[model samples]
Target: MLAVLIPLVLLMSGLSAGVLLGTQLGGFPLLAALPTDRYVHAHAFFATRYDPFMPICFVGTVVGDIALAVLAPEAAASGFYIVGAVLALATVTISLVKNVPTNKWVQTLDPENLPEGPDYEGKRADWGRWNRNRSYLAVAALVANCAALAALAVLI
Candidate 1:
């Protein structure tokens, strides 16, 4: 079980981390540079694409990590799996509490006539920051997953 789960967790974590890193490096900056109307449209487009994919990757990682931890509690790798699971869970929590609402709001907006005031910019910035934080958590989880694999290698 650990054999199968370890690799699965690593794959999900790697995918999540890579996408988030790309978004932080490329997508966010590109959107940030656009005019409000353009940003609104582009953000809506980009946001719609990541949906079920990212959530599946993230939740899959968490499940895999927890399974690994439980299945191999005697192994040194279990500690790393627990840490990885916590980090991955944090990424999900932030996405639900912070980023998702902002995404939902952006999707409803009219690009031609955005919010009346500075709220749009503030919300966008907050979304970017939350996403960046989630990215960091995902990267950290990937590192922990890698460390778990190494520990398993040594233990096995």
Candidate 2:
């Protein structure tokens, strides 16, 4: 069980990092560079692709961490998994509250409706910062989860 959980947790953490980075950094910049009509269509497509994946990754990290905490109480008693879970929660919260709203706003924009160049650049940059912050949190959680997994590995 411990062996299985460790790899699963790592896999989910890796995927969460990839998806978040791709959607925020990759997709946003790509959309920002395109012309208005293309931007709208691309942004909508990316969001549709992202929304389905994000929740599963987020929940998987949370559940995996919590399960680790429960199964290896001694390891979690040291607070590693707890800290990881907290970081993961922050990642989820920022994604839902900050990033998702920005994506929605971007979806509503038409090329005719937006100012040229720097206007969209500024908007994309603002949301990019949020994405970076979430990335940091996810990385931290990954570290914490890995630490707990390591501790469990040693114990077993």
Candidate 3:
């Protein structure tokens, strides 16, 4: 049971982390570069097109890994799983606390023109910073997950 679960989680979490890293590297820069209106509109456009499923996939896999960790039979193996889960969960927490509200604020602005009140550039900068941090966390979780899976593969 544990053997099946560990590898299954590895596949899911690894795929999610890989896609997230790519999207953050590839599309997020576009959001930072555009002017206010274009930035909002472009986010909407990209969210509708390129990102509709990615977030769901990422969250699902992270949650799946956590669940598997909770269910694992051995203490040492569970410790590695929990470490990966905590790192991945931190990324989720950051996304909810930082990214979502900032995104909501950005989306509400007029895409035809720069928004009034608060510094637009600063908001984008802060958002990008938060994203970078989350990306690093995701990378760490992915690495931890892979390591755990590899160890489990050898044991099982």
Candidate 4:
């Protein structure tokens, strides 16, 4: 029962992380195309939605990994747990430091007052790069989680 539950919880947590990171990354290109007004609104919405999830997911992931590690020591030592934890931490840092601040700046913009220029392009590119980095971390974490689950299954 413990064996089954641990992996299941970790898998779900990993899936949630993947979804959140993937959406943030995948949405960038679409967000880049929006007019200033639309971009501001979308940025506000994303900021509202994105900030809360990282901490929640980070806690869930840490708890899930710890639980799995205790339940399956052999698998834990295989480096999956370590890799996953690092990746999760990276994702949290990227979202909190890089993405959230950019979103806040976007929210401050007055669409009517703001001028179109190279600054917007530069900012968008920076945000896009950071988001892409977050996506990569998320994918790495997911792989580690999956590998751990497989190891747990085999041990069980």
Candidate 5:
């Protein structure tokens, strides 16, 4: 079981971290710079692509980490897995609570007739902040996952 769970958790956590980091470093800045009309459309375009993929990766990572935490031979490895699970869970919670709703709200806008003001821009800023937070959490989870793997490797 460790054979399967170790690689599975690493793969899922790594993919989740990579995607979130890419969005933070590349995508968010571009979207933040766009005018409201362009931002709305661009956000909708980028947002839809990640729907099922990210959720699957994050959830899979969580489940794998939990399994690893329970099954690990070494107490340190199990602790690392527990930390990874918590961090991954935090990423999921933030995505559902903050980012998903923002994405949904962006999808509903007409773009052509968006209200004129700082309100919309503020929304974009808020979204970016939340994205950054989740990205950091995902990356932290990956690190914890790696540490868990390393601890197990040392035992062998």
Candidate 6:
């Protein structure tokens, strides 16, 4: 149990935080640099097509979380771990239910010919707010994972 839980917790924590950092340092900057009117739409569209990190991180977080729940009942059964897992799940859920669709909607807009109906700036603002919230979730997950790991270590 220790063998499995230990690595999984560490991995989930590390990867969660790492990806958050990447977004803060890389994705956010790139998005901010793009023109809000229509260039952002084209850039985001192409990025969704070419980017690999988001997919990898998403899969990793979901899989690691499920694994942690199964393998570490002590951790998963209550408190920080549960919060972490729930937040992790929420993070993915938001991405699926909100962000991906937003990106797809943006992508369909022509860089130079986007319809006036969709408020690009509003969308950008909403995305930014959600992304920040997601980052907070990631950070909380990382902390909770570490706490669980530490608890498990003390017991063992």
User: Which candidate number maximizes lDDT?
Assistant: 5
Residues 8-38, candidate 3: write the lDDT tens digits.
Answer: 6677667667766876878787787787777
- Where is model 1 more than 4 Å wrong at Cα? none
TM-score, candidate 6, is 0.77
Residue 74 Cα positional deviation in candidate 4, in Å, after optimal superposition: 1.4
Sort by TM-score, top down from the best: 5, 1, 3, 4, 2, 6
Which regions in candidate 3 have their CA more than 4 angstroms from the true location? 48-55, 70-75
- How many residue pairs clash per model? 0, 0, 1, 0, 0, 0
Please provide TM-scores, in order, for all candidate models, with all chains considered together: 0.95, 0.78, 0.81, 0.80, 0.97, 0.77
Better of 1 and 3 by lDDT: 1
Residue-level lDDT of model 2, residues 43-88, one tens digit each, is 6667667666778877888888777777774745347877877888
> For candidate 1, what is the lDDT?
0.91
lDDT of 1 at 99: 89
Q: How well does candidate 5 match the true structure, expressed as C-alpha RMSD? A: 1.1
Q: Compare candidates 1 and 5 on TM-score and give the better one.
A: 5
Which residue pairs in model 3 clash with each other? 37-111
Model 4: colliding residue pairs: none
Instruction: Answer with 1 or 2, whichever has the higher lDDT.
Output: 1
Error of 2 at 54 (Å): 1.5
Which segments of model 4 are wrong by more than 4 Å? 1-12, 24-26, 75-78, 115-118
lDDT ranking, high to low: 5, 1, 2, 3, 4, 6
* Least well predicted 10-residue stretch by lDDT in candidate 2: 111-120
- Measured with C-alpha atoms, the lDDT of residue 50 in candidate 3 is 28
